[model samples]
Target: MALFLLAFGVWSWLLWPTFLRNILGDEQSWSNGSPTAFLWVHVVIAVVSLVLGTVIGVLGWRAHRANRRS
Candidate 1:
């Protein structure tokens, strides 16, 4: 579980930034010189996922270290 969480976090870290960059660059991401709903929604999702992934990964890492110490 710890390893899984770590891997998930890593994957999120690797994926979200690139995904966001792509989303921002895509013509469909904007409308009339402003960002579209699609862009906003994806931005929100990416931010939430990043926060959750980091928190979960940290918890998992702490648990793993605690287990090892015992």
Candidate 2:
């Protein structure tokens, strides 16, 4: 599960810029909206993934500790 979340986070991190461009509009061609606005959405996704990854790591650590204690 941690590995999956880590993979997802990495995937999103890799794609975030591309996704932002798609949302805002292509840089090399005609663009219609504020790139900054779409950038915030990208920021949100990044922040959420960071938070989720941290949570997953913490949970995994706790589980490991519990297992070791028993």
Candidate 3:
């Protein structure tokens, strides 16, 4: 589980920036010089996911270390 969480967190870190870049460049992401709902929603989701992933990864790492010590 800890390893899974760590992998997930790393995946999120690697994925979100590229996804955000794609979203920013996508035509559907903009409308009349403003960002569309699609862009906003995706950005929010990505940000939240990144934060959660980092937290979960840290917890997982701590758990892994604790287990090693026990």
Candidate 4:
């Protein structure tokens, strides 16, 4: 579920703006706005961090469970 949310969030950041642009033309609209370079970099970081955090959390949880069982 977390992975799915992460993927969705990433895809939304990447494609949603362009999709809105297509519907509303080049000019800014209520739905679709052009993304700045800074925004793109931020989005990438957000996606990466989400995935990395999830992996780290899972590993920690597994280790904790193993220690309990032992």
TM-score of candidate 1 versus the correct structure, residues matched by position? 0.90
RMSD of 1: 1.0
Candidate 4 per-residue C-alpha lDDT over 9-66 given as tens digits, one digit per residue, 9 for 90 to 100: 5555566456544534433333245655555555566566556656655665566666
Among the numbered candidates, top TM-score falls to 1
For 1-70, candidate 3 gives per-residue lDDT tens digits of 8788788888888998899899999999999999999999999998998999899888888888888899
Per-prediction count of colliding residue pairs?
A: 0, 0, 0, 0
lDDT of 2 by residue, 1-70 (tens): 5455546555655765566557445453333543454456566875676667566656666666666789
- Model 2: residues >4 Å from true position, as ranges? 1-35
What lDDT does model 4 reach? 0.54
lDDT of each: 0.87, 0.58, 0.89, 0.54
Q: Is candidate 1 or candidate 2 better by lDDT?
A: 1
Model 4 is weakest, by summed lDDT over 10 consecutive residues, at 23-32
Candidates ranked, most accurate by lDDT first: 3, 1, 2, 4
State which candidate, 1 or 4, has the greater lDDT: 1
Clashes of 4: 0
> In candidate 4, residue 21 scores what lDDT?
44
In the range 21-64, model 1's lDDT, one tens digit per residue, is 99899999999999999999999998998998898888778877
